[model samples]
Target chain A: MGFGGRCFRVQWGPSALRRFRRSGCRTVRLSTVRDSTPGQRRVPRPVDDGDVPSVVALSEGRRHNGRVANQSGGVTHMTLTAVGVDRPGIVAALAAVLEDLGCNLEDSTMSILRGHFAVLLIVAVPDTIGAETVEAALAPAAHRLDLTVAVRPLGELPSLTSNDQTGRSRTVGGAGADLGEGEVYVFSVHGADRPGIVERATRSLLEAGGNILDLSTRLVGPPDAPVYVLHLTVGFPPGSDAAGAADTVRATLGEVGVQVHAEPVEIDVL
Target chain B: MPVRPVLTLPAPVLTCRARPVGSIDDEARALAVDLIDTMKVSPGCVGLAAPQIGVGLRAFVVDVTGHRKAQSCHGTFVLFDPVVDSASDLQPAREGCMSVPDLTGDVRRASQVVVSGIDPQGVRRTLHVDAFEARAVLHEIDHLDGLVFLDRVAGPHAVFPRKVYR
Candidate 1:
């Protein structure tokens, strides 16, 4: 009777087979309506006035859609990336061309990689010149240098200012709290390839509520006698009455058979 | 008027040989104050030579105490007609100038130095310094010798495009 009751949920009666075959015989189109709201959508307004608002707004929207725009000023942010054999006056020639376009050089990082000079620039100009004009202006320099030039309109500029004005505090990388006024200790430990050394020291410091600011570990020594070195700068809570925090860490690490050097860093800058 | 503007690059004054101070008088003291004021506003400046401020005198003001590398350092200094008594082996460091607003270069300098000079009151003094302090002193002294940071750069690779330092 129990087995019969369990089999009742399967609907293995003749009606179940007939319903499945009938459903397969019919055509059904499963379509979905995406919610594309008006306010959420943006329309591209090219630089007519060449003001920052229009240029930034348009370029920024483009960036969110996975595009890079260099438009700044009223004009679009101009960008040129070139890689050519290193020579004198390459930068000079490029700078002069940008200056002629009435373009304001915002930021540029140029370096010689191997035997070639690679340049990346963020330039701005008044909106009076359109994308075509900018392309034409840089063409001569690109030709003279025998370099490739790629131009594009920039999307809006992202807000770079810290957003911690509200009550919520912001931390870099969003994992730990920001550094507070307290004693900072820099600890270095080296031991033969072993387990439980890092774990033991970290657990000891964590129990004492010490915050690690920056930690770096590297492996040295021969493969047969591998050495692991851990260097860490840690922060302690303010007025925690822990004068020998570094020593305490060193002692815990010593039991793990690692040589440790713990010194109080001058925390005046923090 | 207020302190005179410091001469920037291509101004010609920055390359002129600085005249040695015969004595520290009111004029010299006023020039020192001008140098201090000029250094304070020269963006990422830590020192100013008289030649840079357009006075072309062998005097300079250094307050590297405010710099990140010079955070732990002796207080400010006002040296008139400074001369190095001795110097250690050369150590090269990257340096930027207010005159050369958008240029930086690696310049060779003494790792440690002892400088003899006069204060604003004409009182003679000597200082023994090491590391970045010595580098700052050497940079300002180069102005006295009619040398700029560009002149000390070994090659184009030693120079850098300047960026605004926070």
Candidate 2:
């Protein structure tokens, strides 16, 4: 069916751009601030005295591990990792600290795993700022929230050029570029957990000239015989045989004892 | 009638329930013409509601004669005070709206529908539509009741950012 024509493509104007900005698309991902009533006072909760020791121990452990490295080159990229007991305001506090340090958050994923809130973020800072400076700046908030924070300097970003025999070019800094001029599809694979499933499936797709845009995997079921589920959003270059590439990916992944399915992510315009 | 600009979200007229066109007067017929004109000028626009063009009246135009998904082909037609006589076979499909640009959402709508309404020629007509034509009719009907696809999405995650089309 010609579903493409049914999807509405917005014609942008000045007013539309203003509405897009006011939509709060940026802050909606990680954190949302609630407006308080005019005269309402929010009382701060008292920090547990016993939590201080563990916070100090965790911070010391991170420092001793030597994970914080100094890069002498003009490195502007850094990865920040933080973990603490799940609570409100952790993201807000960390964001405040980063803002004070003049760091721009590029990409981040925050989630609660086994009752602990973890944040892993890629940030861009001035060339003069080192990983140690970020770690030092986060020390106060980390201690206040009983979080273990670490920062590691990243290597040079990959230039926007085709790196392999395939004509696909890698997006700079891996910030997940828009799938320009491509056919987007969702690839789903699920089966009993085993080693090399991701490698084998992705390798076959890559060979078929499919570029993985976003990927997420989960392991569930009993630990003895865990089931793995992998979902990937991939893009095939325009004019490429998307159906043939999907069949190849499915067949390749099927050989690894998994059920694979691929479908076009269709959008309808009104 | 000149083709009017299609209004987007947060436009109060789009959300307010459109008043019924009790009589097919010159103004109501003019609205029908404007709806069709606007839909024709907007490439790929299969349907348009009166409120989308700031009319705030119960009327819409739909055409799916050549669409690939269209099974029950209906040439361009305008309806005033459309009432869905019957609808069945609910199915979920992703749809975008000119009024809610930059996003698409999954909406469960009936695959088969029978509707009766007053045509611009001052005649009563009923249509039995299925597949894409039915979907288009239901979408335009929503505007008459002050509802959009955003209100019908399955959940928050059901909405997705749409790529801009040149």
Candidate 3:
């Protein structure tokens, strides 16, 4: 797969699935269950009038089990997701719970979309704390705040290695090895919004043997005619023709009705 | 005079507002010489401030003679108790500091400036500087005020990690 294809996988969730379906995009529900741990399992109960008390009872039981699992030393990493209506104190409450559970927040992205607030966090917990333990601990806050919470254990990070085809070392997510040896440039494309814009631009650079270091896209302007803006940091091999590659990308994007501009990102050390 | 060790972030001396040089005594003259010597020793360094050498004195040395970016080239000079008389034509440019290594930021500084200070000979002088020379002077003045390029970054994303220096 190309660098953009591998790194820019669209996040699919229940709401996202529904939106995709409405937009006439083909999407499938990969899994309904949030947590994927084997031994301790709790199926998501359908929301109904009589099931509320039972759900609370099950959560309390899980919390009791979590107390027994609290041991010292071994560390486990997991991804935590929390979504609810926009309100103050949600982050503080979630942070308080994590702190109490002896978990460290490593990396996280939080933002408010429409009227809903979403938070995704990568946290490290002590070995004694399982995915169930984290979910159970968050139950009270989730219930009180009317939020959906899920926790799933993460696998080990993939080791970085050199790509045989390009003869250049590439890290997961397209972080090029030692930018000092390579030339870095900022590439920007802005114009009318259209499908396949991202794919086309990224494919051109990839074909030219350029690696994307970072990228972000935004759709702005009037609701009737939104403008698409794509900004990316790309790196080229030491002796590669960076200007030629950029020219090809510009011409390719220009054919698709987007204006392109590229400039070398200067870094001065004093 | 000898080349002194340049201080980085978290060094208390770099953060505190430097004290003015009351007079250019033997000690002050030696500090000026050390600043110039240290700037010469550090690769690609065009300027050095007293606070960078752990001395909280209002003094600095700048020499951008052969640098490509430099336009109003000043061979080499040292100043004590420097004050920016007037600055105009603000422009945003990427800058890194010896006192704040490993990171660079886009900071907006005046492109043209008139600065007054006492030279190494204890004589007062006013310099009309622009382009890279103005930038170097402004950067050193920031050090005297306990500020780095990080403080003047255009936005959060303006700061970037510097991979290498050669």
Candidate 4:
């Protein structure tokens, strides 16, 4: 199928000549200054000495090496992966440690795979806290659970800027390579895990004008069964018949003894 | 003309709906010029509204085409008494406001739009735009309605800390 219709070219207007001054955008509510009531003092209030104790400061402060300070909002994001022999309280123990550090768990996904419990979390903590503090504070818990842990700050949030007036709707790639005419399509293929199963499957898709948007695969079942579960997102040519693409993909994988299931994504309006 | 101080959130005038353009005469043209001059004089600004300069009039200026990604759009316009046609689907975009300093947010808006309004010369015209142009036009239209970007933020994550966006 040929890519026809409009190529979606960009358009320009007189505003093109003017320089974009980044005037910050925000709104404010009006606050009417209320006059003080008669006989009401306007002097600053002072804290009572007895109510505020200045005698002793508690807790020792330590200089953590390689601490990246997150001074923005109170929200924090952390990705943690843990693997350990089946044992109770592994999560509880680790969670307790994080809670003690004043971290709030936002969201988490956990699964038992290959006899190991893996957990990923989006977390939040008080501002001015550093990644080092979280790692150090969680180190003891990791050791106790007998699971290795890795920690890093969350990736920067994406922002849409008007500096470029070309509102070309774009989908970004994790590998930083722009996939041509990308669209999100999900695929699942089940077959015996072999050296070239994934390679052949992806190759077939690429030849049919599809780009793999996201992919994850795993060897499943016992060694005797030797089955595999492959999950991936592929971009199809805008003009390609989506059903035909799916069928072609399935047929190509079938030749290699792989079972494939593919479907177009139904994107909800934002 | 002096660079007018941008009124921030909590400024009563920001939410106060502006009056329609009575006539696109010298004073209205002067407001447009002051807006352009004031915006240029400020550090980094893309648009300005009369309400931001303490005028409650349905007039604003925007020029996003000079910025990145917006190069394909109509760069600027002195939109007066504008109305956005809602004939297209809404798309969400991250937006910042000059009045509400230090905040940015994701705002749902029409992906394409046609704006009808009187120009400084009292001539009525309709401008068609899509995507970023639609977004910029919608943003300025909000100003005419006495609305701010903060009002469009869906949630906390929808808003971001201000960066030195030139």
Return the number of clashes found in candidate 1.
Answer: 13
Docking quality tier of candidate 3? incorrect
**Segments in model 3 whose C-alpha atoms lie over 4 Å from true places:** A1-86, A94-180, B164-166
Native contacts recovered, each model: 0.00, 0.21, 0.21, 0.00
DockQ (Cα-based) for each candidate: 0.04, 0.14, 0.13, 0.06
- Deviation in angstroms for A189 in model 4? 19
lDDT of 2 by residue, A1-270 (tens): 112111211111112212323332111223111111111222222222352322211111112132222223333878899988876566666765665565555446666655678778877666778899889999998999899999998887432222122212111111112324467788889999999889987887788788887677899999999999999878777777778887887787778779988998765555
DockQ of 3: 0.13
Candidate 4 residue-wise lDDT, A122-145, digit = tens: 545555567777878888878876
lDDT (10s digit) by residue, model 3, range A1-270: 112111111211112323333433321111121111112223222222352233222211123224312233366779999888866556656766776676655445665656677777876677777999999999999999899999999887221122222322111111222335767789999999999888988998888878887677888999999999999988787777789889998998899789999998765544
lDDT of 1: 0.59
Q: Using lDDT, give the best candidate's number.
A: 3
- The parts of candidate 1 lying over 4 Å away from their true place are A1-77, A84-107, A112-117, A123-127, A137-146, A153-270, B1-17, B33-47, B51-54, B63-77, B94-107, B121-128, B143-166
Q: Taking the tens digit of each residue's C-alpha lDDT, what string does model 1 give over A1-270?
A: 112111011101112222322333210111111111111222232322343232122221222122122332245555666667765556556555555565544545565545567776665555677766777787887788787766666666332211222211121121112223466566889998698877887877877778776566778889999999998767677765444666777788787788988775431100
Candidate 1 chain A minimal-lDDT segment of 10 residues: A4-13
Q: lDDT of each model, Cα atoms only?
A: 0.59, 0.68, 0.69, 0.57
Ranking 2 against 3 by lDDT, winner: 3
